[model samples]
Target: MGGTFDPIHNGHLVAASEVADEFSLDEVVFVPTGQPWQKDEVDVSPAEDRYLMTVIATASNPRFHVSRADIDRKGPTYTIDTLRDLREAYGPDTDLYFITGADALEKILSWKDADEIFALAHFVGVTRPGYELSAAHLPADTVSLVQVPAMAISSTDCRARVAQGKPVWYLVPDGVVQYIAKRSLYR
Candidate 1:
């Protein structure tokens, strides 16, 4: 469940919870990306703010918790590194699952050290509308599919709607929306 989590939203929670429930996972970790390789060309919201919002968004769910591994890492965050660190922290036998957007999974071949990631833990892809991932090109066979409802809403969309003074209440949790407003995240 590692992501930039620019601001945690319903899609993320729903997909993660669905996966946890489906697989009976012990806990779901919400990892905030330190510095996303994909976002190297643009400015991202600060890690501290993203982490705080993630904490606030998941506070009500006992099954969900935030991980600071990615945030604390000094270099560009890699999924393999994050997964390795998590495996070490949770012990070797822990049944860990990494949830990601299906679109990202489609581009796994381009990721660095992608082969090692397949051996790390299970990958749960959250399918949404439009972009469908090709299972044929998976980084590894460890990739498991869990088709959660397409939450058409994305962080970028939410941010844009917020910047335009549009109502974002329906796209994310109310508390999370409030946190964004209080912090002026998109504005």
Candidate 2:
């Protein structure tokens, strides 16, 4: 699962858990972006902060792990590079799945090396609130659409809540809440 994971919320965890269970995945590695090219207009939090928050959010799950592949890579973070790196690490024969929200999956064709991405890993598009899960625009063979429980929570909302001095208790993991407060993020 690849995302910016600015604060790594419960919605993310739930989605990963649901996908892992449905697909019988051995592990779910959360890869935080170093610099999100698509989100360049916004002032993203530091990569280290995002990575740490992801670590805190997924630490309890034995099957979940954090990777610094995207954070360690220089320049803009792209899905193709992430898949390629994982392919190299796990070997060419390993079956890798690129899990992402439906909204992001809709924009897959616009991503860098879009066609090649499908060759690297299979894509799993999880349903998100306000986004329809459809593979009409994607290759049917390489993509799978899953309907996860509705989670309206979003990183943007979490950041806004924090900036407005509102509590985000259950929106994200408890450790993430504490880490955000400790780091003074999204202030």
Deviating ranges (above 4 Å) for candidate 1? none
In candidate 2, what residue range of length 10 has the lowest lDDT sum?
A: 128-137
> Could you estimate the TM-score for every candidate?
0.95, 0.98
Candidate 1, residues 17-95, lDDT tens digits: the string is 8999899998999999998888889678999989998998889989899999999999889898899899889998898
Q: For residues 77-173, what per-residue lDDT tens digits would candidate 2 score against the true structure?
A: 9888898899888887788999999999999999989999998888999988898766887899999988889899999999999999999999998
Candidate number with greatest lDDT: 2
Candidate 2: where are CA atoms >4 Å away?
Answer: none
Q: How many residue pairs collide in each prediction?
A: 0, 0
